[model samples]
Target chain A: MKVLIYGSGQLAQMMYLAAVPLGIQVSAVDVGNHTVVDPISKRSLELSIEDAIEQADVLSVEFEHVPEDLLEQAQSSGKLLPNSEAILAGADRVREKAVLSKLAIANSEHRIITQVEQLDEAVETLGDKLIIKASRDGYDGYGQWRLAHIEQLDSLKNTLSQLDLQNVPLIAEKMVPFERELSLVGVRGLQGDIQFYPLAENLHHQGQLHVSVAPAPDITENLNQQAQLAFKKLVEEYDYVGVLAVEFFQVGDSLLVNEIAPRVHNSGHWTQQGTDTSQFENHIRAITGLPLGNTKAKGKSAMINIIGCDDYSTDLLSIKNCHLHLYGKTVRPKRKMGHINLTGKTYSELAEVMTTLAKFLPIQAFPKLLDEADKLAAID
Target chain B: MKVLIYGSGQLAQMMYLAAVPLGIQVSAVDVGNHTVVDPISKRSLELSIEDAIEQADVLSVEFEHVPEDLLEQAQSSGKLLPNSEAILAGADRVREKAVLSKLAIANSEHRIITQVEQLDEAVETLGDKLIIKASRDGYDGYGQWRLAHIEQLDSLKNTLSQLDLQNVPLIAEKMVPFERELSLVGVRGLQGDIQFYPLAENLHHQGQLHVSVAPAPDITENLNQQAQLAFKKLVEEYDYVGVLAVEFFQVGDSLLVNEIAPRVHNSGHWTQQGTDTSQFENHIRAITGLPLGNTKAKGKSAMINIIGCDDYSTDLLSIKNCHLHLYGKTVRPKRKMGHINLTGKTYSELAEVMTTLAKFLPIQAFPKLLDEADKLAAID
Candidate 1:
């Protein structure tokens, strides 16, 4: 079977690796434009988007932010998985917020603003401390602004008034004091059968993900049930198919929905080491109408992102149970060049392995990792 | 770093899959003649073998039976890993027996016959009941003859004299009444570091491997130590620098060395899902001078060969913890198409899963699977 992916990135490359063992061919379109690159071959072909889409048994996106025209064309072929609406919902904050509201799921308090004048009311209604996100094309701390006080609104409004907001409205959210961030990566098959990897605890640096520990160290039955309920509601309502990653903010005992990624998310990378079948294989299985694989975790796992550093050694493999997955990318500051997944028989062992990993990573790019190591050390 | 493999078969393809995630490009040379084929691209390129060897950072063989000229050429490059001698040892039964005797390892009582007349002494000295094998290019059940009694030896000598035994000599052995067969797949790094996976119980049909169960259900520390010690002797003597699979025959409480494969062998396929890091990845690491990953088994495992069968369903994936690996080869009777690796948290659980797998497999191709399932059922 052949699968076509919208983005020729690490996610697609990983998918290619997972699919090949199962006799499936995964081809990725650069989405940087029209051209399909077989991630396995790293070979690019001058193929039209339509031609590529037509060749696949199923069409899926690595990221939700694929071009609307391409999504529309793929949808027309009836091959687009998770559907265009689900992708748009993930791409735009407004659609995402609406979807959460319809499911009666808890999210940060927010209001939509289309003009500079509405910013003043949004500040009053939501709060002075707010996060303003552009409804579309926003990610990794980009296309967003933060407000700390009422007095700051005018300058922010003055800066905003220079541009028209009607085309791209702002989702003004009242910042909440939360405990920590978590993400649940779940796959819903075309038959509507659902399976989820254990929720992964996420740590972000400069608004980009740095590291993730799966089965999120301090999880409870209640926490798992809460995430499952939200996932069930959203997937059922949208008739969702394929992996959907939901980011959450934990406040006291309650979990608030933060964002939805309509494709495989980085937080779930630990599945490569910790689960019976990885999230990539499950996503491929889900999207291709194959039976969903077992999501049973084999052990505790930590996935630390290798940001911008290509000089790292495979000496990390010397650390028992540490597995390195290097994405073939040119080095650039803060870019996710690769990730190392460390698995252990127990959480403490996993934590110890992560602590050892922090030694090999640059302190400048891995302060969070160091801090996490310290916390794990305290427990030890 | 790039790795050039000697064979463009399924083993090279799997190594290609494992290496790509570690940012390594593996170019496979179809040793049937001189040609380099990128297993992933499925594209063949006509390149000079010398240029290919020089281009590779490391050279390794997928199988041990490459042509001597090719091995010699690769050897001169100072890159052929595990070395040409190691490859030749695996290829010829005579050399293999010599290595075993040099290590003082036990083997079935055998005599080398360079001439047909040696058959007369072989029967008188060794025993009447004997199994004779051509020292080179013999595999599965081919290139073999049997003499049940002394009277039969004259007829066997008469039959053998129909041809010459100059280039291809025979190893005639007094057949041992063995209980079962077992194999140990171990990797030796450049730094002399070594790790061994637990012995795998193997079942053969028509002298071709059928099914293998790791941590061999009935195991004693003595049996494990014996295999490890023999492995240590063989690898140390050769200064081996990659995965080596040693096949053994069990006689009462003792184990006799049957054979050694100098590359990733079919018996180690269980490591793909059963261990922290697979034998293929470890072989890649060993040759590249990278740190070896852990060989710790994640669980009990069974690897059933998918020989000559392409009509198998992915429904095997529906079986919990079952992983399908198709070689993408055209079906032919007795050809190794691929394998399925099934893992479980315990021996009993693994037995149950293997039992379930037997249902999906053709009885003709997998009688051992049925027998194993019946045994497991009896235990249940």
Candidate 2:
């Protein structure tokens, strides 16, 4: 079957690779070029976006930021999965908050604001230390405004007023003093059979994922169950039929929903080497109405993102438990260039290798280096 | 750089897949097609054999059965490795015996015969029960004659006399009652840097690899060391500069060399999901002069070949810790269609998975099914 994915990024590239072995043809829409690139055929062709949408058996997105008009067109084609509604919830902070609140899921209290005048009430209700997020087109720390005090709120409010919040809307939420961040990636088939991967502890630097360790360390059984329940609730509530990633902030024994991603996610990269079914393959299975695959961990695995750097220590390969995966992307500053996957017999052993890896990886380029190091060291 | 492989089978296909992520171009010579096919580019073109050899950066074979003329031409290009000399040793039973004897490697006693008249001496030297094998183009139980008793030796000799043994020399060997079969897959670079993957315990059915377990079970430290030493000796002795797989018969604590494969072998398939570096990727690195990757096992892993039939239990994907890798080939009887990989916290867990997989797989087509079942059950 033919699958069409929106956005031609590393995720799309990997998904393309996964699909090929299953004899599934995958084509990607380069949103920048408004053209389609057949990953298997390596053939580029110009076609109307609607025609491409109609031609594919399934339409999915690599990320949540596809233009709404194209998504609407794809929805009209009756093939867009997790569907535009689910993707919109992920794309817009307001919709995401509403979905969480509607499901009685814990999240930071927030107010949807469209104009600068509303910022006064937002700050009064949400408090001085707050996070202002554009409801659309924001990722990797972009389109976010953080206020540390009341005095800074005025300038932030003015900055927000100057932007086109009228077109996108905004979410001003109280800053959460989270102890750590974790994520639950689950797949839901069309038959509503859902499979949840173990919660993954994630460390981010500069708002981009730097490292993800499967079966998050020191996680209380109660809190992990809560996260899985919240994830299941969201998937069933939305009738989501693909992999859904729910980001959470751990506070003592409780977890608060931080965000939701309606497709295969970065935090789940460890599954490629650690799990029986990789998130990419499971996503394909979920979307194709095939049986959801086993999500059990193969071993303790840690994934280190190779951000914005083309040159990596080939010597990492010399380490006893490191697997280097270089995404075929031209390196650019702060861009996700590739990642290294290290699997070991135990979490502590994996952590030790991660420590060795940090020595060779540039800390400035990868913001979560110290955090990743600490997590690995603390795994025991 | 462009690499041209001499055979278009699953190994070459996998190599092509691995090369794509590295942005390397790969084309394969399909002996069946008598032409070259670009695996990724999916472009098929005809060219004079000489032109194809000259166009490649290096020439390698997927199997050892390349026509003598083609081997000579490729060797004349001065890029064939581990060289025609090493390949001939694998291809010709006579040459293989000579190499083993010269190296003082432990192998079954054997004699070469060019005519039926020599059979009486061969029988006397080797024993009553003898295996007569053609020196060239014999694999998977083909091109061999068996003598169960001394009385039958003359009839076998008479039957062999009808053929021109001069044109096709045969090697007679005493049957070995090996305890188990094992293999060590290692890679050597031109600069003499070497890396060894852990020894693998292999179970074959119908003369085909049915299942392979990494870090061979019940392996004593001394035996493991001996296997590694033997592998190092063979690779260094041959000046091998690519992946060399040395098969052995583990009789008690000792290992008798069975044969050597100059390229990636089936027993190493567990590396795909079990190792820090897959054999396919490491072969490319060793051949390309890149730094060798770590050969550490991700976990205790078992690889089960999906032979003959195309249909197998997709249910294996539902079981925890199972990876289904289909080769995207149309299935036919006795054809190697694909394989499944299972990785677990321990060997016993891997064995459990292998047993569970066997129930879903058609063991009748593969001769080693019962042995695989026993091995899986012995995982503890």
Candidate 3:
């Protein structure tokens, strides 16, 4: 079986690693250059994009932000799993909000704005406290502005007016005082069967994910059902096949949809060490029309992103149940170089491992480690 | 870091898979032609053998039977782990027996025969009930003969006289009635730290391993200690620094050494899904001078080889905790195609999973499945 993934990044690399044992060959596309490459070595394969698509049994993307022209070409092949529509919904915030509204899925109250003048009415309707975002190509806290008071609205509009709003548009969301950030990573098989890994609590620093803990502590049964229900409605509506991630904001006992990612997600990386099957493997199985492997967490696991630094001691592997996954990339500030996965029987045990891990990592690069470790340690 | 392995087969392929995440790149030598190739795709690399050797930080092997010339070349590089002496000990039964004698390790009662006339003395000393083997280039039940009575001696001598006994020699052994076959797979690190996975009970069909159950049922503390003691003695004797396999025949409460493999063995494949660290990764770590990962088994597990068949239903994955590892190979009678790994919390549970797995496999390809499953199910 041949799977052609559209992005030659860490996710594609991981998918390639997971696919090999199942007798699947994975070739990755360097979207920046339209060159096909081996996911591990990034060495270009002697094949054109058209030839790769022709030979592929299935076509998928590692990220939602793949170029539209490439996505359209892949869609024309009739082998793209989850389809381009689902991917577009993930890429465009306006489309995502529309999908949630169409499915009657609970999410944050937001309004689409295609003009700079719309910001005044957004503040009046969503109150002065709002988070305004670009409708497209915005991620990791970029292309966003915060409105803490009515006085900041004019300046935010002025900043937004510097760009062509009508082309990409904007989403003015009420800044919700959510209790915590949680995400549910699930896969929908070709037969329409869905399996979900337990919710993972996500910790972010400077708008990038730094750490995630699976089977997030203090989760209520109702919260889990709410997350799954929203997930089910969205995947069913799109006839989605493959892994999809839905980020959520918890308010009291309810979960409000924060965003959706139509790919194997970073929050699900914990499954590599803490579950019967990983999300990457499940995604491949879903696209290949195979049975989805188990998604149940075997134990509590924490995934700590190795961002912007590779200076830490590799001896951290000496810790029991600790595993490192380096992406074989050179370091750059805030770049997601790789990640560390630690599994333990309890949240406290995971925290202890994380604490030990923190001692080996530079605190400046991993800003959320100590705080997240403290929170997990306090869990019963 | 880079690792170059001799023998481009499934073991090398698996090592490549395990090494990628550790930021280690592995290239394999197709020993048949001295070509360096990608272990997964088997594509010939752009580099020559000399260049590959120069680029590799460490050299190793996936099997002990690599040709002597290649072994000598690797040894001269001073990068080969376990050393060529250890590998030669595994490849030549005569040298292996010498090592056993030097270390005072208990083994089968046997005599080395360098001439056809020595067979008469071997028969007298080992008795008529014997198993005779070529001292070199023999494996997987090949190059062996058995004698059930004294009446067969003259015919065996006539058969042996037609060959060059002086070059290869022979090992004539008294065939003992053994209760079971068990193998201990372990790794020795750079600093001489050793770790062993629990012994695995092996079941063979036509002298090829068909199934292996790890943390073998009915193991007493004394049995485990003896296996580890023999392993420690051999590794320390050679100053070995890689994964090694010690096969044993259990006679009453003692273990008699059957043979040793200088690289990852088939019996240790169970570690891929059943333990915190797989033998492949540990071997890489040992050669790269990194700290070894955990070796403790997570639960009772079984590894069933998929030999000479691809007709089984992939739906076996629907069986919970079951994983398929298909080595991309053309089917041929008696050839190893791949394996299935199943893990469960108890012996009975693993048996139940194996029974479900058996329903999806052809009986001819998995000759020992039902019997082994029955045995495991009967365990308390």
* Candidate No. with top DockQ: 3
Which residue pairs in model 1 clash with each other?
none
True contacts kept of 3: 0.86
> What lDDT score is found at residue B299 in candidate 2?
74
TM-score of chain B taken alone, candidate 1 = 0.96
Number of the top TM-score candidate: 3
Please identify which of the two predictions, 1 or 2, would achieve the higher TM-score against the true structure.
1
The digit string of per-residue lDDT tens for model 2 on B1-380 reads: 56778887778877776665544556788777578875533446556556777887878877888888777888889888678887887888788788888778787778888978888898777778888888888887678889889889768877888877787798888877789999999889878888888899898765678878887878899888878787777777788888889899988889988788888888888898787678888887777666788788867888878888865666656667677666667778767878877887786677677677777766675555556656656666
User: Which ranges of candidate 1 are over 4 A from the true structure?
Assistant: A45-48, A162-164, A377-380, B45-47, B150-164, B376-380
Given candidate 3, what's the lDDT at residue A219?
91
Model 2 alpha-carbon miss at residue A8, Å: 3.2
Return whichever of 2 and 3 wins on DockQ.
3
Model 3: C-alpha RMSD to truth? 1.0
Interface RMSD of each: 1.1, 2.9, 0.5
lDDT of 3 by residue, B210-308 (tens): 999998988999999999999999999999999999999999999999999999999999999999999999999898998999999999999999998
Q: How accurate locally is residue A129 in candidate 1, as Cα lDDT from 0 to 100?
A: 95
Top candidate (lDDT):
3
Mind giving the per-residue lDDT tens digits that candidate 3 earns over A1-380? 99999999999999999999999999999999999999999988999999999999999999999998999999999999989999999999999999999999999998899998988888878899998889999988898888899888778778888889889999999999999999999999999999999999999888899999999999989999999999999999999999999999999998999999999999999999999999999999999999999999998999999988989999998999999999999999878999999999998898899999988888788888888888988995
